[model samples]
Target: EPEVTQTPSHQVTQMGQEVILRCVPISNHLYFYWYRQILGQKVEFLVSFYNNEISEKSEIFDDQFSVERPDGSNFTLKIRSTKLEDSAMYFCASRGTARGNTIYFGEGSWLTVV
Candidate 1:
């Protein structure tokens, strides 16, 4: 039962700084995604990648964001400049084949920008 892993379950940062969140998705998974929940807000999709390029990206993935698969098992999300509104629980998820199409998620990487 291998699962996705995200580092720094929590992070606190100033209003303007750089932050890099890391994740290791399941070994055989095909799709990788980044979703965020802003405190009490609903889960929002930031981006999804497959075959080493972006499949889809939501409006929230603005100029300040970037993602990478630096190795066989590592996925990373980088934010060059943070803002107060950037505080959220960032979840790394992988979609796999079940009986049908379904997506699963990691616990999350929490970011607090103040």
Candidate 2:
């Protein structure tokens, strides 16, 4: 199975700063997603994108957060004005078009806010 890849395996930034986490989904996948785990908490869904547009998003994804497919292969999540509450392991995921296709997650980008 193809896998998703994320950049900046780990990052440390000050509160109120902006951060952009990048990911490259499987080349053949049509659906993409961004999820995060806050320390020991369960994973939380942030947003999902398809056809170059956002298909769904969670309440956790507020104005401070944004997702974009900058190109055919690059999907990115930008967090404006980061906060300590935002510290978490951000995971990039992708799935095929077929129903029930497994969603594969990247190793994850660990964001630490000071």
Q: Write the per-residue lDDT of candidate 1 for residues 1-114, one digit (tens) a residue.
A: 788899989999998899999999888887899999999989999999888988899999999999999898988899999999999999999877442466778889999998
Off by over 4 Å in 2: none
Compare the candidates by lDDT and give the number of the best one. 2
lDDT tens per residue, model 2, 1-114: 578999999999999999999999999999999999998899999999988999999999999999989889999999999999999999999999885799999999999999
- Evaluated at residue 41, the lDDT of candidate 2 is 91
* Poorly placed runs, candidate 1 (over 4 Å): 97-100
TM match of model 2 to true structure: 0.97
Q: How many backbone clashes does candidate 1 have?
A: 0
Question: What C-alpha lDDT do the candidate models reach, one value each?
Answer: 0.90, 0.95
